[model samples]
Target chain A: MMQQTSDKKWFDELVVELRLRQVHGSAIGDTVASARELLRDTGQPAEEAFGPARDYAAALEFPAAPGHDWVRQALWPSLLGLLAFLLFNQAVTAWTQQELLLVSPAQLALLATPVVLVALLPLYLDAVVRRLWVGIAIAAICAVAGVLSAVVAPTQPSDAWLAIDPSPWLIGTALVMVVLSVRNTVRSSRAADDDEIIDPLSGTTAGTGAGARILVHVTNWLFPVLALAMLGLALALR
Target chain B: MSTSTPDVRATDGVDWPSDWLRATLGFLALRALSGGPSYGYAIISELERHGFGAIKGGTLYPLLTRYEAAGLLTTEWRAGDGGPGRKYFALTEQGRAELTRLSADWRRFVASSVHYLDPERPEKEISP
Candidate 1:
């Protein structure tokens, strides 16, 4: 049991390393299955049979998908959704209070913090995924920036740099979020098979269960769902 | 009870220089697959039984992957007999031809090396 757990962790690391290299899902699956086959035959621990997961992943030469494919497919849409979600959050409370939405330069800059961090993710994504501390540090920075943005928001229109009726902004941001979520959902369900890692022995993808489907759905709708929660909280507080 | 050599390192009884093994493992692997389709562990065992040192999967799989990409070897994943599926590698025609060529060249090289190293040969033949 202990060996199995460690081997599972090793395999998980291998998968992540391969993903970082942008190997196709089917090729990743085949690499994983073959490695597992050797381990079973030799009765050797995974790390012993294969060297470090990262090095092993680098050693295998598989045809990777185009390098910037994810940028077009996933990153841009997610970033846009994030922008819309932030706009919705800012507008929700003002609409709830039946007041104008106030925007200050400092507030705008602060709100852009997470968006900028996310945009720069592809640059250091491997380090962020490989090192736990990097991920935690980024999350901490985003959280601090989020709290500071709320604190700096103007209470009165006179104190704000720009003020406008909150109704259109609220409606527009919500529409954007919903549309992006729908598009993401459709794309994911269609592309899931192409991106899934299959276990050759079991004749199944890594996760084909109800739980996995639910997780994918939740991921597809995350931004909109969070926006709705923020709206409810603003209404309740008002 | 046995005497140990002063400069010898312990190994799995057959410890050829690592460089030599690294250089020849490609053709050796091709030769292994020449008999029939074989999985990774079987290929390693075949090489070890023939007096080559144990080859780690870490070292062997990458070479196999390269050959597969180069069209020298083809692979198939088949269900095992009451066990997990196995990925078997077989030599392509190109791989067999490569093995044949490498083996003949290696034999000729070995023969020349043996002739040059023979103590009974005249000094003038190697004077240069």
Candidate 2:
């Protein structure tokens, strides 16, 4: 049982390391399966057979996708979606209350905190993935910023830095979020998306089951669903 | 070019320095594959049987992966009998050629080193 757990952790680390290196999923799957094969054959523990996962991943030096390809395809879209979602959150309450969306400088800055942190993720992404504390810290920062942004929101126009009509902003941001979600869904559903790990022998993807499909759809539609929830909360509060 | 004893055995009781193994494991691995396509454990076993200390999968797989990327090797998955499939790695033509060249160079270097270390060998006449 202890050996199985250790091997499981090693394999998880190996997958993460490979992903960080931008290795293709097919190649990652092949590496994993091959490593498992050796372990099964020798009955040696994963660490003993493969050394460290990070070192093993580096040594493979598999041909990676273009460095900025993920940035262009995934990061930018998610960033845009996040920005849209934040804007929608801000505008929803104001629209529901039939008031202009009043923004204080402090509130805007606080609101921008999560977006900025997420935008800069490529820099510390490995640290965030590898270290539990780093990931927790980032999440806490984003969550605190979200709560503080609400607290710092202007209660009246006199206390605001800017007041703008909320309806157009609300609709625009919602549209942006929905469109981006649709785009993500389409991209994920495409066969050309090589993100799914495939079994080398069977040439079949690992997580193509119904549950996996639902999870993928949920992820793709996450922003839109969150926006709807926020809208419902705004109406209820009003 | 000698197919006999394709497995290179280390001298008895003297472990080759890791630096030496690290330097030569690449072509040595290619030479191991030169016999035919082999899987991970098989390759490691061949090396270990020939008295190369156990080459970890971490060490061997990466080298093989790089070789595959460089077109020096190609891999195929073959189903095991009542077990998981095995990834078999075979040398390409380029890999074969590289192995031959590296083997020749290594032999020459070893011969020269041996001759230089022989105590009875006469020193060459110096022009100066």
Candidate 3:
């Protein structure tokens, strides 16, 4: 007797195996199996039966974590704290100088402090594994900002661009933000699961998931663009 | 390839265990497909029928997948014709050749052992 079997039977079997493993979100193995059976009955190969199954598995196994969300969470609060600290310091300094409270670039940065600080709130909850690279970048930026503030702080008021001098206290605050940001980001990245192959420290593809694309998107576009905007704002006001 | 060479005991007189058990399983799997393509459960039951009940699902399933990947076995999906789904596996020409060679090795080993250890004794010379 010829034993004719349909391809759908084999596809159903594969579906059951994948379900037994609990591969993805809550999947009904029997239902998936039945669907596979239907496909096979139509004269499809086993490969055809499994295409959707593979995609569903990939999505569950690798969830994306956007870089902007991570950076904002970690750095926002710290930025606000620094701004508040700077503004308060400026207010006291201006009072001692007997000058009217005015919006200097430093004072404007001080006013923006709360926004920066609130932004840091998100960083607190982030896994250290996720923020190491962003932290490093922030640290580098702060160090450079500190050096510029210290060297260029003007002793006398002048209309010339070179007359401005950044206070040492302001420079010191930037350095502190840099150090804290680097520390938190590194700690968070290392604490995350090893399965996440992207190194949070450098925002680069370490190995696993869709890490390569996320890293490229973050490093080549997001952070650089934000950093450029920040520089432009500071230069324009100065 | 070096390990699979035909030398056997001819190699420096080393007494290799020869992994005979695994070879036997592979040989049986190949022969089991000669009747028709079968699935995991069918293969396990066939092995059980041959008095090799130690073969379990965990061992057989991985082995089947590995064999399919190695090109010694080919599988096709069969749907709804049976009550549920199943992946039916068939032996390839390479597997058939391997089974023939392994069967020959088993025969040679058995014949040599029986002839050396339990050679036929005359009825009158048999000890009580």
Candidate 4:
């Protein structure tokens, strides 16, 4: 029983390592299926037969998508969504109260903290995945920056770095958020469960459970959903 | 290359040096496929049955993947005997030719070493 649990973790690690290399989903499925087949044949635990999952993944040398493809397709889009979300957050409250959106230099710097952190994620992404503390530290930093940005927000035009009408920023950012979320929705829907790991013999694919599928769509629309909630909250307070 | 070939034991001990096995496993693997297509466990079993100490799947699969990548081998997923599908690896024409070339070179090198290391040979005469 204990052996099975540990082997499960090792297999999970193997999947992650392979994904980090940007290996195609079908290839990842094939690799996992073959590894499991060998384990069954030998009746040896996965680690014993395959050595360390990380090392084994590295050894396979399966062809992968170029490293930067995800950055171009996924990261840049997420960053833009994030920028729109942040702008919406700032603009929503001011629009609700019929006031100009206030911005200070310090507040803008604080707002950029998470965006810059996420932009550079491709460089330290592997490290962040491998180390729990690194991910937590980054999340903590972003959260702190968010709170600090709110605290430093200018209260009046005299004290503000830039004070502007909230309506245009509000409408524009909401449109960007909606457009991005729609794009993500279409992409994810088309992909469906195609990325799931499949068993060659059984023709069964994993990660396609109804709950999991729902979660993927929710993630794709995360920023727009969050923005809607924030707008609701601001209206309630106003 | 050495015509002074003397009658020697047809086989050596199974305890070959690790370095020796490392250098030649790629060729031995191709030779294993010379019989027919085989899967990972079957290939490992064949080498072990022939006295290569149990080769780990970790060691063998990567070698097969590399050979496949180099077009020296091809692999297929085939249904097993009421079991999960197996990935069968078969040598390509290039692989067969490589095996032939490597086998000849290996035999000549072994023969040269055996001739030079003959106990009856005067070592002092050959000393630099």
Candidate 5:
């Protein structure tokens, strides 16, 4: 049981290390299967047989896909989705109150905190993945910034830096979120876009079960779902 | 322990320095594959059987992977009988040529080192 747990952890670390190195899914799957084959033959623990997972991953040095490919494919879409979600959250409250959405410079900076943090993720992604505390700290910072942004929101239009009608912003942001979710849903359903681990010998992919599909859909639609919940909360408060 | 067994000597419980293994394990591994296609454990076993200390999977797989990437080796996956499939690695023609060259060079280097260290050699007597 202990050995299995440790081996599981080792495999998890290996996956993270390989992903950080920008190795493609097919190659990662092959490397994993090969390692498992040796472990089964020798009946040795993964770490014992294959040094540190990070070191092993680095040593393989598989030909990675272009570095910025992920940024273009995944990150930009996510950042855009996040921007839309934040705008929806801000607009929903004002729409519910039938007032213009007012924003102060302080509130804007505080609101930008999460977006900036997420934008800078590529820089500290290694630290975030390797250390639990770093991930937790980042989450906490984003959460606090969100709450402080709300607290610093201007009550009167005269004190605000920008005052805009909430109706268009609310509808526009919601549409953006839904459109992006649809795009993601379509992209994810395509077999070529899926990166499930594959069996090298049989050439069959693993981890494409119903649960995985559902999880992928949920992730794709996450921003819209959260925006809807915020709309509900705002309506209730009103 | 058996006279019938070829005198393929083990390292006799003495651990070879890591530097020595790191320096030679690459070509040694290619030479092991020269016999035919083999998997990770098989390659390690062949090396251990031939008197090299047990090579860890960590050491062997990375070297093989790099060789595969360099086009010196090509890999195939064969299904095991009632078990998981195995990834087999076979040397390419380039790999075979590299192995032959490295083997010849290694043999000459070893022979020169042995001659230099030989107690009966006159060169040893004149050494400062």
Candidate 6:
């Protein structure tokens, strides 16, 4: 435990330095890589970098930003789960055309409330706050689902697999549960050891022209928007 | 082989530093640099901002010198925005590639770990 704490402290300290903009932008890669190299060279077991694992998941929720590191890894899966719920809700509503059976806009907003709130909050808050936010979000989903299920139960048609309108609340809750479960698994993995660093000795770049670099940056920002627009067009045309 | 005494292996079961530490250090440095370029002091300060205050001058200075020597990082001497001239360090392409590789590995590690720890569905398990 002591060793783990120290490792976390060590990594945390490095992050602090980086956040202050002290490290030269060009050397950032090497500084991080070298520190990691030193640790391995010194024979310490690498800590796990768990947060980046969920980057794909989070990208589902928000536009991707470079170098946010763990935020994407941690919140992404949750965001994806929420997105699935939203999509599923839309599908069910479009299919059933029942306002009560599906989630109302208010409920959808409520469902998103916890995650967006947690996300928008300043990072300076306590870790405990983050944990609680996650927990409360899960609980809220379940509660909303339960209420929806009860309300929808009596309205089911005889041939329907579900007796009532499929409650958007219930579906959303289930989705939240799925996301939370994933997050728990992620959290347990490698024990959130703050000590873990990524690869070192990997500082090579393609060194394209300045124009190319700007183009790359601009394209990164635009790719998601273009994709989203395309998706919207497809949905509208469908 | 010259004149130094031969090193002996430790009989005690204490674990020495491993490659993980070195990789972690390098990853952190790269992440820091992604923000902007800086000299030693600026890098140190940046580390502090990221919640890594324990990295003092003793550990940081030698590491910077070594990185410069390896050409993984390049330094240009520049007058300070406010004060004296300082050596600025930036990532070479080789260094940036290293960061990408490390980041991917880190993500993989996290995913595998999560897979092991919570393999079951949430509805299946109830916590007290």
lDDT of 1 by residue, B1-128 (tens): 11233454444668889999998999888888887899999998877767678898998999999999999999999998887889999999998888899999999998999999999999999977
Candidate 2 per-residue lDDT over residues B11-89, each given as its tens digit: 4444779899899999989988998999988887777767777888888888898899899999999998987889999
Clashing pairs in 5: none
Candidate number achieving the greatest DockQ relative to the actual structure: 2
The runs of at least 3 residues in candidate 3 whose Cα sits more than 4 Å from the true structure, single-residue gaps closed, are A1-238, B1-20, B81-83, B119-128
For model 5, residues B1-128, the per-residue Cα lDDT tens digits are: 11123777755454789999998999988978877888889888778877788899999988998898899999999988998889999999999899889989999999999988888899746669
Report lDDT per candidate: 0.89, 0.89, 0.48, 0.87, 0.89, 0.49
Residues B1-128 of candidate 3 have per-residue lDDT tens digits of 00122432232223324365455777677766767687655665565555455343334544555676577888765653435556677888887777688778988998987765665746554456
**How do the residues A1-238 of candidate 4 rate in per-residue lDDT, one tens digit apiece?**
9889988999999999998989877778888888888888898999999999999999999988888889988999999999999999999999999999989999999999999999999999999999999999999999999999999999989999898999999999999988988998888777434455676666767777899879988998899899999999999999
| Model 1 lDDT per residue over A1-238, tens place | 9989999999999999988888877888899999988998899999998889998998887778887988888899999999999999999999999999999989999999999999999998998999999999999998998899999999888889999999999999999989999998898787455778877666578877899989999998998899989999999999
lDDT of 6 by residue, A33-85 (tens): 44443343333522332122122122112222354555566556545554554
A1-238 per-residue lDDT for model 3 (tens digits): 1112433444344443443333331223322433344343434444443344434333223223454643564455445445534444433343445443344365344344444534554554333223587666655655565445434434345522332223543455445545554554454456343223232223333343477545633532333244345445554544
Candidate structures ordered by TM-score, highest first? 5, 2, 4, 1, 3, 6
Binned by DockQ into CAPRI classes (incorrect, acceptable, medium, high), candidate 4 is medium
True contacts kept of each: 0.79, 1.00, 0.06, 0.79, 0.94, 0.00
- On residues B3-66, what C-alpha lDDT tens digit does candidate 4 reach at each position? 2123532332467788988888998889888888888888777776666777788988888888
Q: Which stretches of candidate 4 lie over 4 Å from their true place?
A: A191-198, A202-204, B1-15
Least accurate stretch of 10 residues (summed lDDT) in model 5 chain B? B1-10
> What is every candidate's C-alpha DockQ against the true complex, given to 2 decimals?
0.63, 0.86, 0.03, 0.65, 0.84, 0.02
Q: Which ten residues in a row have the lowest lDDT in candidate 1 chain A?
A: A191-200
